[model samples]
Target: MAAIIAADHVSKWYGQVIGLNDVTLTVPPGITGLLGPNGAGKSTFMKLVTGQLKASKGAVTVLGEPIWGNPSLYFRIGFCPEQDAFYDRMTGLEWVTALVRLNGATEAEAAAMANRALDYVDLADAAGKKIGAYSKGMRQRVKMAQALAHDPELLILDEPLGGMDPIARRKTIRLIKEWGRSGKSVLVSSHILHEIESMTSNILLVNQGRILAEGNIHQIRDLIDEHPHTVYVKADQTRALARAFLSEDDVLSMKFEDGAVIVQTARPDTFYARLTALAASGELGAIHEVTSPDDNLQAVFEYLVKS
Candidate 1:
């Protein structure tokens, strides 16, 4: 499938400070998680696609047209910025309606569309409530409502779940996934790895203002696994688990640590499978807790830097 958004050797810089560097990528019709740290050029890439910034070099296109100086293209692209800024005096409904009207809709048409957007985010009841009075999660939903009011073809969300509570996060994730199933493209940016992982398996990993990796999380995870994974397994049979792991070919090393057996393995899934059967057979004893401190973004970052 042709990409809805395509960047060809794109680079952006603020004088000597680089924001992005030779990052090439393509986003087709589906949800894609933009994974990176605070200053990892994620926002730069999003801004480029949204036409908020002109690329310092190379080119970027959205829907077969260059995004630079293309204000008209916004009619089909909705953007929720990373920073939260709002008209506190205005009710959520009024704010959303006003923004929709900027799309050239009449007051009546804007209001109707705004109401539907509010409903989609489950903020209908609070539509008339003051923006300043809404909870953090509600405010986040309000931002989403404005983005949905005109029903754009693509959604460029920067930290869409930033202030959401657990329940609201789940609801919003479900909505994002529903958009993908409905065949609407969504480019979601977030520092929360698990949240993005929950929404989509496809991801674009950026670091030092460059594209470090982009593919299925599992594929990247497999490559990162070459760095060796340390899994802390807490169970009554710590010695037994250690002994059982000693015979495994993939096991690199094993040691006891703070009431837990720390096992280093190159093949985690296989180790997990063996552990599962051992527990079921009443051999490994009761497993209480399992934790892999480096299994998240830190591991990915470490592997990227080392490589």
Candidate 2:
């Protein structure tokens, strides 16, 4: 499949600090989440793709064409910047219409496109409301609407769900999922693991200005499975559970705590499934909780860094 975006040995630096260090990645059609914590060069990579910033070394391409200083690429690309800055004087409709018109649409066409985009984001009711009067979620939807006004083939969203209530976040996630299912190239950057997990399995993980991992999240999980995983079980009888887990060959270590038993295992799913079956058989009574202590994006990132 043809890639919608490709970065080849892309590196960016400012003085002594590196922004992106020889990172290479490809984003194909469909939803691909860029997972990273803040200051992980996610924003810098986004800027490089949008031609807002130049890389000190290497190159980035959008839709097979180089992105830097390429205004022509804007016709097929939409970007929802992470910045909170916006013009408060204009109404939501006015704001989006202006951007659409700038992309070569006629004034009447811009109005039609803006209205359609607003309706898609469920912001039609607030079309006339000034941006200053809008809440954070409303502003987010307005930003989304502006990005979609041109109906671009590739949508680059940076922190799209930031500062939204649960309901708004749910709605936005659904919209992005739908867009991905329709086969548009959508690359969304987020620090939240579950947020990205809920959207798509295709992911690019970054940490400290470098690409750490890229592929199905399950592949990364498999790699971690080779390493020992810490599992925590909270229950009324910690000692009893710890004793039971120690008998298994997969369990590398066990310890008891305040009403809980923490076990280290080389095989997490197998161990967890066995424990579940044991509970069902009345062998472990009234099991309160079972969680993978090592099953998190931070842990995964740290494990890769150490490797």
Candidate 3:
């Protein structure tokens, strides 16, 4: 597959501080989650791609054209920034229409595009309301609407789900997923791993202004599979179960606490499945709760960032 965006030895700095260091990457079509905590240079990378800022060294190309200072690229790319800046007094329709017009669309075309973008974001009913009166979620959706107004080939969403309610976040995730499936290249950035996890398994992990890892999340999961996962199990039998788990090769370590057992294992799903089967078959009785430390993205990211 042809890469929509490519970076080679991309390095950026703000005087004494580094933003991205010797980073090289290729972003293919479909949804790619930009995974990193705050100050991880994710924003810098986005700016580099959108031509918002020039790279201190190296180069970035979007759609085979260098992104820096290229006005024409704006027609083929849409950006939803992390900042919450919006026209407080202007209605959503007015704001989006204004941006669409700035993209070189005629008044009628801009209005039609604005309406379609508003509808896509489920903000058509609130299009006439002042942005100041809109809720945070509404504001987020408005930002998304503005990004979608131009109908760009690439959608770069930086923390699009921030400040949204869970239901709204879910809807946004679904929307991005559908867009990716429909052949649009969607690159979304979020510090929250579960948010990125729910959107797409393809991730570009960044930390401390560098790319820590990139590729399928399951592959990264496999990379960390060797590390023992702390699985907490609360059951009626504590010592007996702990003893049983200690005898198994899959269970690397075990500890007893509060009438429950915390077992460390390399394969959580396998261990969990076996444990459940044992309990179901009247071998291990009365299991209550089972939780794995490696099941969440935060833990996995922490490990990778440290590595």
Candidate 4:
């Protein structure tokens, strides 16, 4: 399938600072997660795709058209920016209606579209309330409402779930998934790994203004698993549990803390199998919990970067 968005050797710089460096990738139809930490060029890439900023070098295209200087393309794309840019005095409905009007909708049409969008984001009840009076989550939802009001083919959501309450976040994730199911394309950026994982398995891992890895989340997890994994085991007989793993060749090192044994293993699968056997045999006493500190995005990125 042809790409919905494509970047060819893209790089963006601000004076001496580099925002994105020689990045090339294609976002296919449906939802694709842009995963990165703060200042990792996710926003720069988003801006480039959305036509907010011209690339200092290379090219970016959306829907087979160049993004920069493309006014007509705005009608086909919806953007929810990371930064909060709002008219605090304006009511949510009024703000969204004004934005939809920019797409050349009539006043009545804009208001109707805005109302539908607000309802989608669960902000319809607060549509008449001033934006300034809304809570952080409400403000976030209002931004989302404006983005969806136009009913664009592609959605560029930059931290759309940020500042949202847990319930709101889940609802927003479900909505994005529903959009993907409806065959609309979405490129959503977020620093939180589980948030992105919840929405889509396809991801682009970015760091230091570069594309580190891009593929199915399971593939990335497999790559991360090749690195040494740190697993914490809390048990009644921690020393006995630690002793059981000491004989294993895959076990690199072990330490004890707070009634838990921290085990570093090169082969986590092997280590886990052995752990399961020991627990089942009732030789290591009662196993309270087994947790891996290296199961997060930061650890995954660190392992990937180092490798």
Candidate 5:
């Protein structure tokens, strides 16, 4: 499949500070998560993709056309930025209608589109409510409504799930999945690992203004597993559990804390299999829980950067 967005040696800097540093990437169709920490140049990259800001060097193209200085391309792209900027006095319907009208939609057509969008986001009842009166979640949905009102081919959402409650978050995630399933492309950026995990396995990891890694999350996790992994096991007999793994060659070290056995192993797959067998054998006391503090996106990014 052709890439929906592409960058070649793209770099963006603001005066003395660097936002992106010689980054190159291609985002395919369907939903791709832009995973990175704050100040990781996610916003800068998204801005370049959306044509909100020009790259300091190199090229950025979306849907086979250069994004910068391309006014007509805006109609095909929907952007829900992280920052909140709304007309507090205007109703949701009015706010979305105004945005759609800017896309050359007729007044009546804009209103109809706005209504449908509001309904899709489950905000039809609040369409007549003033923006100032809506909750944080409602405001987020309203921004999404405006983005969808124009029926763009690609959606560039930056932290769209932020500030939303559990129900609203799930609903918005479903909507994003639905959009991708409909054959549209979505570049959704978020710092939360599980959020992106639930939406799509395809991800691009960014850190310190550079692309660290990009691929399926499972593939990335497998790469990360090459490094030492620390797993914590809480059980009634921590000492017994620790002793059981002491003979294993892959077990690097062990420690005890708060009635939990913390084991460091170079081969976590082997360690986990042994642990599961021991638990099933009923030799060790009841095992409460098992967790790996290092098994997360942030840790994975750190490992990638250091490697």
Candidate 6:
């Protein structure tokens, strides 16, 4: 797939301060999660891609055109910034319609688009409510509405899930997946690992202004050998499995759950190998399923950032 956003040796500095280092990446069409903690240059990269900041070195292009100072390219791009800035006095309907008008839609067309976007975000009922009166979550929905109202090819969202409730978060995650399935590209940035993880398996892990890792979350977690990996297994004979697992010295501990066992081991490969052999013997009954619960961005962060 061709890249919608491309950055090669891109760096950004605020005077003597560095916001991003020599970071190179290509974002193809689809939903790609930008995973990193705060102050990790995620925002800086978003700004550069959205044409909000000029790169200090190298180049950045979106849709085969330079991002810097190219206001026209924004017609094909939708941006939801990290900040909470808003027109306090304007209603959600007014605010979203104003933004849609920037896309050259007629007032009537913009109003219709605004309503459609508000409905997509499940905020149609509150479209007439003033921004100052709306809760943080509602305001976030308004921001989302404006981004989708234009129906851009690429949606660039910065910490969009911040301040959302669990239900709203789930809805937003589903929305992102829906957008990707519709064949549009989305670049979403979040400091929370699980938040990004729920949105897409494809991730760009950034830390200290550099691209640290990219690809499946589990693949990245596998690279961290310093921590114990936790795997959950469901089996017909739980007691038999526990007895066998407890004998393995490499397994640090074991926890019993309803019809399942959670095992922590420093050597995952050996543990998996043993499980395969034991399952083949039929002494432990049938092993229904095996999964690594911590095979995610949290494991990678615990190793890369927390360690």
Reference-based TM-score of each model: 0.76, 0.75, 0.75, 0.76, 0.75, 0.75
lDDT of 6 by residue, 1-307 (tens): 7998899999999999899999888988899999876677899999999999999999999989998989999899999998999999999999999989989999999999999999999999999989999877777889999999989899999988765643455577789889999999999997655457667888998877889888776755355445676777777887888899888888888998988888888776677668867776778787755655424335556566554
Query: What are the lDDT figures for the candidates, one per model?
Result: 0.82, 0.82, 0.82, 0.85, 0.85, 0.83
**lDDT per residue as tens, model 5, 1-307:** 9999999999999999999999999999999999887788999998999899999998999999999999899889999988878999999999999989999989999999999999999999999999999977789999999988788899999989775644566679999999999999999998755567679999998888999888786866576556677777777899888888898899999999998888888776677667767766777876655655524446667766677
Off by over 4 Å in 3: 219-302, 305-307
Q: Per the 3 Å backbone cut-off, how many clashing residue pairs does candidate 6 have?
A: 0
Q: Judged by lDDT against the true structure, how good is candidate 4?
A: 0.85
Model 6 weakest 10-residue run by lDDT: 289-298
Query: Looking at model 2, which ten-residue stretch has the lowest summed lDDT?
Result: 288-297
Deviation from native of the Cα of residue 155 in model 1, angstroms: 0.6
TM-score of 6: 0.75
lDDT of 3 by residue, 3-44 (tens): 888999999999999999999999988899998767789999
If both were scored by lDDT, which would come out higher, candidate 3 or candidate 5? 5
Please give the distance, in angstroms, between residue 256's alpha carbon in candidate 4 and its true position after superposition: 26
lDDT of 1 by residue, 1-307 (tens): 9798899999999999999999888887799999886778889998999999999998999988998998899899998887778999999999999999999999999999999999999999999999999977788889998997898889989888774544566678899999888888999997645557778989998877998878786766556556566766777878878988999998998889876888888776676557656756765676655545424455668666777
Which residue runs does candidate 6 get wrong by more than 4 Å? Answer: 219-302, 305-307
Give, for candidate 4, the lowest lDDT window spanning 10 residues: 288-297
Report residue 115 deviation for candidate 3 (angstroms): 0.8
Q: Report the C-alpha displacement of residue 102, candidate 5, in angstroms.
A: 0.3
* Candidate 1 residue pairs that clash: none
Candidate 4 per-residue lDDT, tens place, 1-307, comes to 9999999999999999999999999999999999987778999999999999999999999999998999999999999998877999999999999999999999999999999999999999999999999977788889989988899999989988765644566678899999999999999998766567778989998888999888786866576456677777777898877778888889989999998899988766677556766666776686655555424446667666677
**Whole-model lDDT, model 3:** 0.82
RMSD, one per candidate, in order: 8.7, 9.2, 9.5, 9.4, 9.4, 10.3
